[model samples]
Target: MTRKTTNSLEEVHESVAIVQNTSIWKKILAFFGPAYMVSVGYMDPGNWATDIAGGSQFGYKLIWVLLMSNIMALLLQSLSARLGIVRQRDLAQASRDTYSRPVNMVLYLLAEIAIAACDLAEVLGMAIGLQLLFDIPLLWGVSITMLDTFLLLFLLNKGIRKMEAFIIALIAIIGLSFLIEMFLAKPDVTEIARGLIPSIPDSTALYIAIGIIGATVMPHNLYLHSSLVQTRKFDRSKKGIKQAIRYNFLDSFLALNMAFFVNAAILILAAAAFYKNGMHEVAEIQDAHRLLEPLLGTHWASILFAVALIAAGQSSTITGTLAGQIVMEGYLNLRIQPWVRRIITRLIAIVPALVAIIYFGEAATGKLLLLSQVILSLQLGFAIIPLIHFVSDKTKMQGFAIGKWTKIASWLIALIIVTLNAKLVFDEIETWVTTSENPIYIWLFVVPIAIFAAFLLLYIIIKPFVEKNRTIPNLVPHINEIVVSESNEPIVYSKIAIALDFSKTDQKSIASALQLGGKTAHYTIIHVVETVGAMVHGNETHDYETTSDHYYLEEYQKALEARGYQVSSILDFGSPKKSIAKVVNENDFDILVLGAHGHNWFKDLLLGTTVDAVRHKITIPLLVVKDH
Candidate 1:
């Protein structure tokens, strides 16, 4: 796992790697960091408690559940990596692009809620780890997690590879600790093998099974894996992409199986050390830690368990914070400094967790962990539905859409997950209503709300395919200085700039700029000759001159000058976004105007260079005249 590291990802989202003339093994090595980062979520402390519970209560019966969940994780994560590489948009960004503002807002909020729920589990885990290892108070331990993550993020700033190495080392600590646990707990091999045979003991077993699946297939990992894989600057060539996908799959498959092993080992240890000894009530993680020393006849076993718990919690916290940022930036179209966002997310997660720990005391943390996972389970559909929708769509992914079998398999997985989540929610509500003399409550509040929730879920699942991809936001530049003269016969102003694509909207942009500048305004017409992704090997966009955009830019320049407002045109070759920005910034123009057609957010990402990029790169008052 060792490799040379250089260059920080500070202030940069995508990172550079040594991708030139490397062996396949080296390329795989370069792509290795992201999947292990994602695997952390699968083995977080929430999963720890569930695994412990399932194993101790049922004695190795839930091992098949662990194996199936890992298979599901491997399939989903590989798809996530594929979406990022080919579409060049993470799940959040793709979702934002696909949905309208209101739907995007709802999805965004749900994603934030999911992140908070996950962080709560990690916080409780960290606090519990501290209590076990150092005997710290629960509230104080929660506070310590924030500082611990702050340090982890500082290391992250040193370089992404360095952070990757640090996380891997922690994962190694976890794996090694469990290896020791397995060695100590010499369970019957035959019985352990039997545990992998699929059979639920009862309805109670189904509940534990649901918990294991929910905890294993995390909602945040979809966003995290898609975004994190972009950090390695791989070649965008045909062969290069094939290589990237291959390496990414290897990384995901290997990492998730490792997670499966770690998870299964925990269950095996629990079954051998607790269930075999008739300590079936040792379902809580803290209880397991407490009982381990006595059962295994060594204090070091408990210490190692605590150490592994801390590693799991801290590692998950880092990934959760990163997922929060991705969701926020992608959906909100706003950026918060990473450290500030991390602090805010930590603060949010700690409050409810702190209250629960205080109200329910030390023993209730395990129950709190389970509750936190339910919160996570609720948001699973929000993430999974959009992900499958985007990756499966031929329009969104172009020809890179998933294959037929993969598409069907992904949808089936999504359905199973959604069904499990619904069952969990319904089971909880039914427990309350039937236990009470409350047919009235069910007739009124429960029935209507349940119906509404079902309808909403149906829309979320269906809307991506049904909704039109065209975008028509109010894109007119709002400037305080835009005072339209009443005399309207083209007032005189000097130096106006308009970039044109020769669309009718380009004429609108020209007219809008002319009206603002008036008769005296000299015009500098700019055209950037660029092919989207033309230089990249796998890119379908081809580079050439004498195209329609060229003709439009030229004819418009001639037509505008015929109206007698002195005009000149500049044509440059490169990326339109960057080249246009350069033209606007280098020239002394009063303003820059570009025609923007209503384009879906996903289209904008696929197109790569948009008016949005131009706006950020220039200081001039830029007017984005809407074409729609």
Candidate 2:
């Protein structure tokens, strides 16, 4: 059966496999990659800033916030993973399918802001790491990170498994770096227990606590985890889906708990090394890096810390780029090339960090990082509300949803996130009013904007269930002219070349081409075998793309021959796009006809739509028959 149109990387859907009769360990192993990809977000440089800030200021008192946020992350991420598994849609694609255009546009904007906010954190972290490690100037370090877009493109072209492995390796480096430093820092056991007792300590401490939560349970993580879980191939049977969800939860729990340790380790290390000695303002990464060696009396402490910082920054940004593509494609229904998308995101993130370093100086970036987290925290409701709404609805999820208590618990987490983030904003405004020289000027700009943001958030939360979305089909043909063709019609072309990806069970293009070419026309149906993930890793799949294409081509050949037309089916493996072009160029063909699946107008442009790619490579005349 053809999978439903979800436009969110359907090309890569079920690309990874799970052995049917494998032992539980092997099954769980198969589900392990997505969460590791997700876990990279949790222990990013943003976590370091908040955790260190909290630790240095309140002496581990905000550990409770970190712990609480992790629990919330575990629940929400579980919901997201389940949403993808069951609905067969990521948050973006799912939202687009169900919401009104205006609502979806607003969400798309919020998602863009959230991605940018998250990227800013990652970029600044990378720059700080560079400063610490190579003694590079912060300005240059920030500028240098723009090139990582190319690195992300390389890893992406390598395939998902290599990408996951790369992220895991970075996580290990960060973990090992901290593990070594944690021992040297020698944190107190009793104070840590007291910190876990759930007291806010003070309002200022509460501000940092909110940041800790934001850093731990990122908004983008919720979206990213949901999308990532669908990559694995599994039985679509009820029992099989249930099993996949169970293993996926296990994967998220174990990986996020590991993230918990790294984030906690950051705070604990900062608390032990700095706070006890009265260094409260050691919030920036470089500041902490400078103090680590002197405070711990170990030569390697700062070095490991810097190396880990670099690793965390780099790893987090790689996934951040992927998350951007997912959100854009899922919502806008168009995906730019991996490298182009990354450059766009990385550029938006880099400019701010670069300015913060050069104009405001390195010390000011600590505030920028905190502001980024707060912005992330503010946008959490926009993401969390829809995620919870989609998964909780019986219409959307049917039988495969969280139970009543789990739903209540998920809402409670959302409520807590909303309340805490609101308080953080309110408290910041209060502080600014009390402390700033130009309070009136700031308020003039901030209050209305804040009100607008809150109103929008409230509307988004309620709009989905409250309003009946005006349903619009994905395509509306402009039918200004009509033509009828008979069997006696003149032959349009002597020979035709048709390239198909078998994205759908589409026969409209073939019929149209046949009618245009008349019964005497000869056609070549071509399929190409791509080196999907086998470029870097040997663990490529059952050659599903090629096999599926061959099966579809056989059916096409049979149908064509039965209609009294001569047809040949060709399957060429390796570099499928190039192969399509080579065949078209080498052969004497009057016209190349390609079946185009209409998504948005820009879908072909962004998605590397097979037709768009093959069209450029061949000088032959082309007709793009559309099936939306």
Candidate 3:
């Protein structure tokens, strides 16, 4: 039996058309947007705080960290894109297939938390930007950020390309804003060069450096990038996969470096405008924004800072929401409306942000933002480790698996992230234990959770090595051996029912029905009026729509009869699914043939597809034919 592989990002999978025979540059253009989507996560509002903190406290000392993080991001993201392109699975979907149900639940939960943490930072960043630029109250600004959830829905409704265009535009604003800021707050070149050389001056610097790395190499971006790359329609053949992997590598390199420039510029701007002026404690985004104009002797400095902050926060929002949808669907094999999924994630992030702002005051946002980054860091290992294992597996990746050197490099990067994140987590838990008023709560709550997480992490790592031949669930079709035989017996349907939408697909449906039942068998052509009067009055309705639809049915019947085929027509009123199912079941048609509408998941979900509903309601075999 033939089965269709369910593509990730079902609505937009292979949505962007790539001209395979085009010039290399043209092909590159088609593969460009996914990486941009991933890159925005690197320079999001979470990174801004860390970058600002690093630059203000240590001057140009941590620029190397940003550079290192960007390199790591590009490497891991390339692997992610490769997985999506070659294996046709996102990180989450891949994880679901590898791990059992309970384990997948744990993995899915962690991913959701990481995304929520990331979104929390975005919400606070957006609120802070509004507070800085428009003097809007922080509370009101955060509430205002909720409205953009709908805005994102609107942009996505347009298309992935449109969404990508929106993100690119925001990224441009961020890049341009910082470019001007860099000019205004000219720093010592010699100092920046020194920062290129790695050195953690002190423990405080080390902490900030880890924060920079954590904020830059986001966990959710891995899930987002892997799924996003599948948006481009590319050839799945060896040559096409090679081209996709190559172009995506270039995409990650350029886009992430632009993120590096944005982040490094943030650090450099803070160094020049604050660190040089002895304002080493300017760690908060608001503090950085407040001091920018005075320190640089220009109001545009502060204005651009706020503008960039807003852009970063807003752009990151779109990807975070998308990641939430990806993880939930990929891990659970459960799909929901994108808007509902997005709002649910946004609300999850919003509640905590609102609580922190309302209770702890607006000043607490910076600490909350840092805490969110830490949560993301804690989840990083889980995402990265699985991705490396999946992409490294020869059986899964086939010819596209990483080479020895690339595999070694990928593991080394994973080791670095895991080590740093472990340290970050330990340091944080220690701090909480030492400083909290109720230290017993840390041991009772945080420590056990940490131990549980550690064990869970260990399980995923060791399972692959121990159980080498564990079967992957049939989540997608693969080339493998199966029992096959040829049957000599001929089969035929005595009676066939064809459902028509009266569009171009009606011809296809009629043809499919004829093929199924043949010229000798009975055929019933079905069409539902579905007019307002028809829905209200059913067969009692008398209107132009009903009369016209009846005539169309007669024409179809007469044409089939002239072709020397046994054909009849049914024109019913009210709902299509119910009417068609009733007609098919009541008449005991041997087979039901209908034209496939070929709508994406979103449309089928929101508007409802007739084929699915009818299939469930009817007892007859359904053959859905696609329109050519």
TM-scores of the candidates in the order shown = 0.78, 0.84, 0.79
Tell me which of candidates 2 and 3 scores higher on TM-score.
2
Sorting all predicted structures by TM-score, with the top scorer first, yields 2, 3, 1
Clashing residue pairs in all predictions, respectively, total 5, 0, 0
lDDT per residue for candidate 3 within 160-205, as digits (tens), equals 8999999999999999999999999988999999999999998788
Worst 10 residues of 3 by lDDT: 476-485
lDDT against true structure, model 2: 0.79
Pitting candidate 2 against candidate 3, the one with the higher lDDT is 3
- C-alpha displacement of 398 in model 2, angstroms? 3.8
| Least well predicted 10-residue stretch by lDDT in candidate 1 | 1-10
lDDT of 1 by residue, 1-628 (tens): 1111111112334543547686767777888989998999999999988888888999999999999899888989988998887777788877766777888887888888888888888989988898999999988999788785577578766767888888899899999999998888887899988988999898777888887887888888998888887776667776677777888899999899989989999999999988888888776888899999989999999999999999999988887877777777777765334566567667777777788878898778888787777677777878887788878877756567789999899989888888977887788788877887867878688778667667767887888767747553422222222222323665544688888654456656766877877766788888764432232321232222324334445555666555665778876655677878988889888788887776676555444546888989998888788877
Q: Tens-digit lDDT track for model 2 on 1-628?
A: 2322433454455667889887889888888889988998899888888998999998978888888889999998999999988987899887887676787888888888888888889988888899888889878887888778888777656666788888899999998989899889889998888888888878878778777777878888877888888888788788999998999999999999989999999999999999999999899887898898989998799999999989999999888877887887788776456556667777767776777677887778788888788788888888888898888877657688688999899889989889887887787788888999989976899877778878887886777678544353533121111112326668879898877655441455565677778778888888665544332232343544445556657776776676677899777655556777888899999898777777565665555667667878998798888776
If ranked by lDDT, best first, what sequence of candidates would result?
A: 3, 2, 1
Q: Is candidate 1 or candidate 3 better by TM-score?
A: 3
Off by over 4 Å in 2: 1-12, 430-444, 467-590, 594-628
Q: Please, what is the whole-model Cα lDDT of each candidate in the order they appear?
A: 0.77, 0.79, 0.83
Candidate 1 Cα errors over 4 Å, as ranges: 1-11, 437-447, 467-628
| Global lDDT of model 1 | 0.77
